[model samples]
Target chain A: MPYDKIILGAGLYGLYAAQKCGAAGQRVLVLERDPGPFMRATYINQARVHMGYHYPRSYSTAIKSAHYFQRFCRDYGFCLHTQFDQIYATSAHFSWTNAAEFRHFCRAAGIRCDDVSPSRYFNPGMCDGAFLTTEYTYDAQVLKNWFLTELTKLPGVEILYSHRPDKIEAVGDVWRVTAGEITAEAPFLLNATYAGVNDIHAMLGLPSFQIKYEKCEMILCEVDERLKNVGITVMDGPFFSLMPFGQTGLHSLTSVTFTPHETSYDPVATFPCQQQSEGRCAPGNLFNCNECPAKPASAWPYMSQLARKYLKEEYRFRYKRSMFSMKPILKASEIDDSRPTVVRVMHRNPTLVSVLSGKINTVYDLDEVLQQ
Target chain B: MITNKEKNFVSAVVYLHNDGGRAVEFFRRVTAVLDQHFDQYELVAVDDACTDNTVDSLRSWAAGQAKPLTVLHMSLYQGLEPCMNAGLDAAIGDYVYEFDSTAMPYQPELIFEAYQTALRGNDIISVCPTHTSGSSRLFYRVFNANSHSAYQLRTDAFRLVTRRAINRVHASSENLPYRKAAYAASGLKMADLEFEGRMGDKGTGRLALAADSLALYTDAGYKVSAGVAIVMMVLALIELAYTLVIFCAGHPIEGWTTMMFVLTLGFAGVFAVLTIVVKYLSLLVDLTFKKQKYLVESIEKIQK
Candidate 1:
């Protein structure tokens, strides 16, 4: 019998979609190109359950985050590593919002904020102000494991590893998804393929998104005992965050100005500008910009140079390894550097729904959209 | 409450917004207490958009501190709630304490006691003011009575939380209008200590803040609206029954039946309108805090 839903990604959101559908007593088939789960954007992320602190400019986003922060902890409390405190420090040089403005934003968004000293791990000379806020980092691998375990227990759900959809077609009310030598049919299809969203859209003869893919890297660092169990973020205008490295007990440092670079596949776009693709991808083969294996490049020097300026006792931090991935962002959201999850159901083709999940905490938003 | 041995480092978070003339002495007293209680400690001072030189004073004092000192300066005045949250995030200590530095009787001495209380395996150690203002007490009574969550909040702002309790508060902080209430609702082991309430300038808008916090923790407005609407409907039904009895007895007053029918229909209309408004409010609250499924950024670590 044809499946009720064919989800085209086994990433966090896809897995969640499958679980939601399966729990609702619908048959779900989740297909992933990677041999296992969390091989894409879902795995290679800071894994922060944001509480709207990141979005000082967008009150709606921040408020929504304040809500999601509670639900995420309650539902996936086991997958969270709340051992560390997360700090948001205002940049003395380039932050768009001053310490007071950011605090005001948090208040308006109904997010909790506390004025804390920067001497614990941050250099007071560099930071104008610092705040300790309500935010947690998730162990992505552990979260994926939890999802897999929970999804497995549900009836009428099948997750296929190494199943990449080469072609997707809508025939009447059912969607025909072709993966390698296998072809599956489902009444509804969800395109949760993160970076590969446009690729799948192109395969299904759909309009290409105005999405831009930035070749980014997450620099893992081995810090001494002093920096353990602390997640520190310097608010934007060249932002940087030194967060606890999931369950590894290390630290992950990321810089906004350093990681984002326009790829050749990206339309002619200005730096710090989002670009839209008005044209559709050519039908036939998948045209995913992130198809190539990412090579670890020289990001440490730039990252460390910026980090040392803000961190206290910079000597303790040592570079370990770099993980490269493509970060998909809307052109508009790139300006403020904050975007809510984009969940769009095809109006003409009700069977098809596409989601560009911006954060891990946004799966609930997808659940709501799917229900609609 | 799962209590572990006290870690070496203790963190004290002080909210300093508009603490003008007393700002300097407040920090000095608080730090002195912190110095006495623990060998290793960090003081997190949150400058809550103080127009005065509060941030400057904090910076100058922090410069000389032997222990770690972190000062957060809010760009805009975010009140006490955000300041508490910010302090929680910056604290790295095994035990974290929060108190207003400008409270008339600067009680840095209480920090040690609160820490000791927490050390005894209490998840939350809160300092209850000796004299609770009559109005504030009534507000808490109503708030606790109407609260929708299982754990009811009883104490005030001053608190010392353990690492685990801190985690729970941080997890639930965003949606909670008041941090103290969220702590009480966390289902952790709680202990309350009484402190002499020093008379100072009572902050204005206490009632407004109380009402706002109550609305935040429970569906107070929705519940009242629902209840009132139900009463109106019930009254309208009773009036309709009386009017029907009178009409059946052929003794309906001239134009009385018409007026009663109109009034009954108006009550029904009001009920319908109120139900729609209540639902809309509920939806607004739901969407306002609905967790969006994704964010713009991504983070990954090196494979072990």
Candidate 2:
């Protein structure tokens, strides 16, 4: 059946966009490569609802995140977990931004940042400063269930799983998209397949963005009671972050040095693992990494050692398993460490909107384009 | 392809400084040796604020290799010791190799040989050249003579150490100004392998590092200060005795006894102040060595 909007990849952005379009009385069709929504980058991430503390160097991006942070918490309050204290720290060595600079940036961005004792969470002489900040994590499963229920109840919205567009062609004022035995046509097409944004653009004969791909690993572990009520992030350099993974009673341990097992600078996400995937994944058609057989070995040893170097001995964690995903980063934002949610109108007549963002709270950036 | 290769994770950390013309060649040789002998190995090249294209050359060469190559860029032109300390801190391996220079005068097989030596109950194995420069020989002689540690100093090209040695060294001190000294002082089993080749030139700021190490790991500085303090105190006592003898012999000059008494008091005060100053100086040294000392700008893993 023909629809007013066809959203590709049922991630947070795609699902949220579908809900908004449906609320505006527009018929929407959602295509998901995975069997369910939030199966890829959305669920396999740090799950940090950024409140501007992560980016002290980029003022604009931090300000924007601070602005959207409140709205996302209020809208998705059911899935948001805010019972624990989140701490941001600056490493004593190799840190780009010192404690003073981070505090100044926080004050300028109008965020709550109170000075806290570094010895409370970190080993002596490891971190220069620690601040208690206000940041929360979202339960991806709860959010996914909410989206599924809302979209199922809302009229004029259809979601098809395991459907990826094999072909996309602009015909007059509509996009004709086909995947295997399914075909759909829509006046507006949205490409919300983050890591696969360039791949989709290539298929549409549009210019690809200058981006790099990292095969990232987020390790889930069970933390001790001492660390159960806290989230810690060592910032501005190569450090580690240990935080609660939503409300699941587990912690996600990630390190800047060990999280990314491999990197690909190609226009599309390419890796040596694709050769061993046995048709399960490829550069053009990216597949799920968490289920891939050729995934890299767990970096738990390196990551845990790094965390232990900074964290106190009382606060401990045991590894459970690893969740893998592909992350795309804009080359331009590397200098200032800013993650900007980019929404580009690739074509005006057929209205092909390609949305690429690293942070989850920035999904609201799609409202301006989707409403127009 | 050899079916039997070492399965232990190895990390080779190479230090670079204005060696742009030679870094690619060095990396190629080292990686070839590592690949042939080890199943899992990573190369960590430390860019010590090189004023040349060393990092660029290494990065370009690393882009084609299958194994991972991580480049650690120092924020400033820190000398070799601190840069290598940072690199070692970043390395995660069961066994780590410290390559102090890019000039590999010996055969590549020697790299694996050092690892094998390290596996044979020796926590630290340093690969050195048979002949060393006259100045280095003299420096080692002086350092070993004054050093309280059992291990002797040598002119080594590279060294291989197990993870246990690294951990012990870290636990012993927060700042590793001189890694060779720290490893030697760690009291772990150490051996030296000598090859028939000439060693490369020392890294930048070698003299200052040499001085710092001597002051830190040896008792020469403390001995010299104590000797000075003792000689000054003895001279003050002798002068006071001479003044008393002159007064008793009826040949005392006007106000000479008073002058001698005041001089003796001054010397006693100076002796007490000197003792306190020495204590303060030692405390300062302790504080300096108990702080984090390296600053890295960034660490980048080259894409294969």
Candidate 3:
């Protein structure tokens, strides 16, 4: 049967789009490359719900995030973890934004930012200022379960796992995608694959986006009782962020310097590990980095040493494990240090729209394109 | 024959300042040597506010390599000492190599040789050329004569240091104005490796750095002030003795002249001693309150 919309990935964007379309009584088809949903970029990230506190250099990005922070909390309050205090501190050295600038940015963006004593949690002379902000983390597992249960009961939505389209062709105002023995056709095609956006475009014989890929690692740790209810992020420079990972008891530790193990400038993701992946991953098709055999060594020593340099000795943590994923960023955003969600209408006849965003709460940017 | 590479992680830090042409060649040679000798390594290039295209060219060249290359940009035109100190602080490895210049005058084998020397129980290893310029030799001679450190200064092309030495130097001072002087005074075991090559041209701000190092690390400044005070005291005693002899011999010397001379000499001697005391107190204040000396604009890691 023909469907109204066909979505490529089963991550948050794809799932949310499917739910929206299904609720509207439009037949929707979702194709997932992995066996499960939210198994890659959506689940293996620093799950902090952005309250516009992360971006101090770009005013638009911060204001947009603050605008969406409220809507996302109101919609998904069941899985939102708001029990911990989130602290954003500016480093005393090597920081682009000083204490005064950070405070000014927060005030202009109209977010909750209150100055606190830096010496309470950080080593003396390490940080210039610390602020207690209103931010929350979402439990990806609980969110994933909620999406699964809601989408499964919808009569108009159908999901296929472990499925990848090998051929995509345009046929008279409809897109026909085939993978092995199954084929699907839809008038509107949405590419919510994030890192695989270029790969999908290559299959359709369309122009590739000027983007770069980074194989990033997020280390999970077990924090002490003193830091269990606290989250700390040193901002506007090469610093680290340690925050709660979803509803899980573990904390996610990531550093701007040590988190990214390797980078590929090609539009399509390329790495040395692809040679030994045995067809599981390649430039045209990406497999999960967390389950790959040839992933780079853990950068625990570098990250831990960086955190210890700023935090006091009492705020202790032990390394649990590392989660790896592919991150793609627009090359133009490098100068302004802004992460703007880009929704490009590549094709008008078949209605091909590709969504690319870095932050989680910016998922609502898909609404305008989908409405069109 | 089978060759086994070392398993230790290494970080090589090089600073570039308006040397766009030489930086590419230097990076190529250094990366080749590091790749052949270690299982894992990283290159950290410090951009000392270059007014040329040095960083752009290096970034393009680094796009084809697989190992990680981090570029640290200084906010302003800070000199070699503070810029390299910032790069060294960013490095995370069991052993670190500090390349003083972008000119590779020596063979590539010298890099691994220095690493081997570091493994043989030395916390710091300085690689210098056998030949030195006349001015540098004179400066080192003067500096070593007054320096109380066990290790002597040299015209080093590059050096290798263990993590322990880095920690010790950081613990010894709040601001590292001169890395070589700090390492020499770190009280850690150190060795020197000499090669048979000519050194390149010296970098900018050398005279000012030389002056600052001598005043900060050597006892020459204090000694000069103390010597002047002693000379003033001796002159005051001589004048006192002369006044007593004149009064006893009845040479018709004016009473006002004798008293004025004695008072002037005595006050000058006391003020000279006070000058030395003030100098010592200021040095203590500087050591205790000075902040970090370097400011980095950003750190960018390029991996291809």
Candidate 4:
């Protein structure tokens, strides 16, 4: 079937483009090479939806996308969740010495601040005090499903999952998409697989670009019932930022940084930065989990030390579960990874367009990427 | 008023690995208490492996128990995962609760409460322990145990994921105690019940037993081990001696040198041994101070 738009790769960006183009009354067909529709790359996310207002860019698009998602959930009858309340914090040591500096950073980030009682830190030296933020955490996986469900329901939309687009290009001025025995023709094509940008570039014959990020993370869960009660605490610093997915069962204490290399996004390479400390103890009475020997921090005592300075002598560490990973991205300058991201090659007409983004960035603005 | 319509019944599944000599006694006590109520239930005993009397004890106990007790004796130890899975598979009740036979036998009320609670339709209800911390009212209000927001969020995800398919996925062994994450992932609804005292098997121990310890003890219950107290105690003493040495050494040694020495030693000690303390603390805090019910053979839930 010949359509107006053909999207390459069924990840966040590709799906976002598919949804928007379909919403714009264009028949959109999305081809994915994954064995399944739920591409594990970016769809199964930590669900950290970006407000994007924090950045210098025109956030109107992001706001529109966020609202688009909200509307999608409401209209489709699926629930997508985001944390209404967020608390940003820093170690007590830093808060005491650099109050103005901290306040300034918060102000610029467009977040509100207060000097209330300091919340507790799971890792002893991880962070000290917390200031609340208005940031929301929308569940990415749910949102993705909802978005796809809603988008395909429209008249001009056909979102297909698990199709390897063998050839997609402007063949004789008409774009042809071949997937096994299935064939779809379209005029416009889009690619949004960040990790596989080179692949898409090669397929579309577009210039390949390099993408880099500073640090990625491994998730930590503090097992003590005390910690579970404490809920989510946000500790902020230039180096590490501790945030909790308390509602979702992920309390990630960040000292580790992960960057996806230009060539790879293998979540295992990056390790958490060692937390630096010289003082006896931070302000909060960090509770030691002297219960289970199997918790993550307790399991990696030496590694945890490298992430932070141990103030207490022989203090027990408590951890529940840990999902270990280093972000699979580049920390250095953007260098082109020469792989075709466009699953298919459109003949000569502009049938598909693709963009690659670091995992830290959200595919909220689907319309902006695909519309232009 | 009992209606003619089919009312949802609630029951728990209790799994017993090779629970050493205590297997028979614990099983007897459990059947005795459960039989008193005459509530519909299933008890699955998975004998991982035993060179001892565990199987013999089960054979005799199973011959006479009034309730439905299914015994699965695997030839070898597949670890706790397979044993729990075996027991879970055997559970035909609306709610399948997990318990460790090595801890004290489950308090009878826990069964009644858990069954009643599950009938009300909680996809996954975390059992808040009422015994350990002494401050019941205070602990109940805090977030679900494991303070990590990830745990909190994963719980909801588990419920959503699991409840969508009522019976197919059973419960994930990956997320326990706070099975809420797995519950969300399974698309299950959630409700929490607070245990009044404690699950029976965990009630003993010199300190307090946690779900973690309960799991371990239950996993090890297949053994003839009244174990680990001595090794743990000796390790504790050595650690203590090390602490005192630093404290005493700090007084006479010059200023910075003593502080430096103490700090270095403290880091090394905490780095090496502190995690065990936290794991144990997670166990204790989960049982004593927290406001959720721990698992037993049967946990009650509220139905839709």
Best by DockQ: 2
Which sections of candidate 2 miss by over 4 Å?
A83-87, A110-125, A130-132, A166-185, A222-230, A261-285, A289-320, B1-9, B18-39, B49-61, B75-77, B102-157, B160-173, B183-204, B244-298
Per-residue alpha-carbon lDDT of model 3 for B80-124, expressed as tens digits?
A: 988888888777667999997988778989999999998899999
> Which docking category, incorrect, acceptable, medium or high, applies to candidate 4?
incorrect
Colliding pairs, model 3 = none
User: What TM-scores do the predictions have?
Assistant: 0.52, 0.82, 0.77, 0.40
Question: What's model 3's interface RMSD, roughly to a tenth of an angstrom?
Answer: 4.2
Q: Which pairs in model 2 have colliding backbones?
A: none
Overall lDDT per candidate, in order of appearance: 0.70, 0.87, 0.87, 0.44
A206-323 per-residue lDDT for model 4 (tens digits): 6544432222334455533333322233332212333344245454444421211112232221112212222211111111111112212221322233222311222223444444
- Every model's DockQ: 0.01, 0.19, 0.16, 0.01
- Which segments of model 4 are wrong by more than 4 Å? A41-45, A51-85, A91-99, A117-119, A122-129, A212-217, A220-247, A252-255, A258-348, A358-364, B1-304
Locate the minimum summed-lDDT window of 10 residues in model 1 chain B. B295-304
lDDT of 4 at A271: 16
lDDT of 1 by residue, A1-372 (tens): 599888888888899998888888889899887778888788776778888888888777888888888998999988888877788988644356768888788878887789987666565434657898778888888888888888979879998888788777778878888888789898788889887777777665677667777767887889877778678899855668888877878788888755543342443212221222222122222222223332434466556645764576543788987776667777778656678788888634437888986788878988775563
TM-score of chain A of 4: 0.63
Kindly report the fnat of each predicted structure, to 2 decimals: 0.00, 0.04, 0.08, 0.00
For each candidate, give the interface RMSD after superposing the true interface residues on Cα.
13.7, 3.9, 4.2, 21.1
